[model samples]
Target: MSPVAAPAAGPSATPSADRVADVRALSDHLPRFFRLVQALKQAAGVDGRDRAALVLLFPLVRVGPLRQSALAELVHADPSTVSRHVAALVEQGLVQRVADETDGRATRLLVTDAGRAAAERLREERTAHLAAVTAGWSDDDLAVLTELFGRLLDDLTAALPADSRPAFPAPREKP
Candidate 1:
């Protein structure tokens, strides 16, 4: 089999052209990044049911009490899907439904102490996974990547119309 060729340097392209190419490259590479994160999640050793529960658990822990609909919006998942996972979480004692103080009839989802502990373990393990993945990179490089990723998310969210945008919270939060 023939070896694959390296991408062209595009040395003669204008700066704007170069940037546009970079953006295109980013679009192409974004899926790989997601897959890497998915791999990391799998490596965290959660079961299939656990995987779904943890998805909703971490966000609910980070954002505090939220209605089921809001949690669905926050995760960009279907409300019905969130409802099913939430039921499992409640059954597993990872989350609890509480009455909204503002409205007696309204229900909100809250992560339990067990949920917080589990999220913390997963968060730390994720960090260790990242550290291993980026072991060759400089600290400055890590910091810059974090800054750029945050800025990229902010810019992308801002580009959306106010009414149509999903709930985009800060990536990191004290739990």
Candidate 2:
């Protein structure tokens, strides 16, 4: 096996060297983060079917009912993929199609009572799990992490082409 060489920095990289290093660090940690999240989800007793339904359930629960296309935009997923997830959710009685109030001809996806219950349970369990993981961290450390992560997401969103950008809700002001 041969060691990989880092890419040579170019003119465009002048001002972003530190940011590039940060991105590399994030890339290295993401797999571990994802594995931990998956383990937590599994421990929460979220069955595969219901776990898959979370793709649709999350947005529906957060933003209220939305047209399929809008849900796709929010999740940064393909419309067809969202459709498939929505179909599974509907079959599991987690979500339902509702008439769009503003446009009668359009249908929106809404989470059912059962779906809300499942989502809340999963959310609570995840929160508890994360709290345990970060229990030793001080309040200031946690606050810094939250602020930096939000900033990273905002910067990434801004870098995307306008048409390719996802529809994230505006950030809420801290009380």
Which candidate gets the maximum lDDT versus the true structure? 1
Give me the overall lDDT of model 1: 0.79
RMSD of each candidate relative to the true structure = 6.5, 6.3
Give one digit per residue, the lDDT tens place, for model 2 in 5-103.
Answer: 354486566645665676687898988988987886677686855676675677688789899999888878788888888898888898999999999
Compute each candidate's TM-score over C-alphas.
0.79, 0.71
Q: After superposition, how far is residue 41 of candidate 1 from its true place, in Å?
A: 3.4
Pairs clashing in candidate 2?
A: none
Candidate 1 Cα errors over 4 Å, as ranges = 1-15, 166-168, 172-175
lDDT by residue (1-175, candidate 1, tens digit) is 1222344578785556666677688898899989987876677677866787786777787678999998888877888988888998888898989999999999999899998887888778777877898999998877777767777888788888886575646674323
Q: Which lDDT values do the candidates have, in the order given?
A: 0.79, 0.78
Number of backbone collisions per candidate, in order?
0, 0
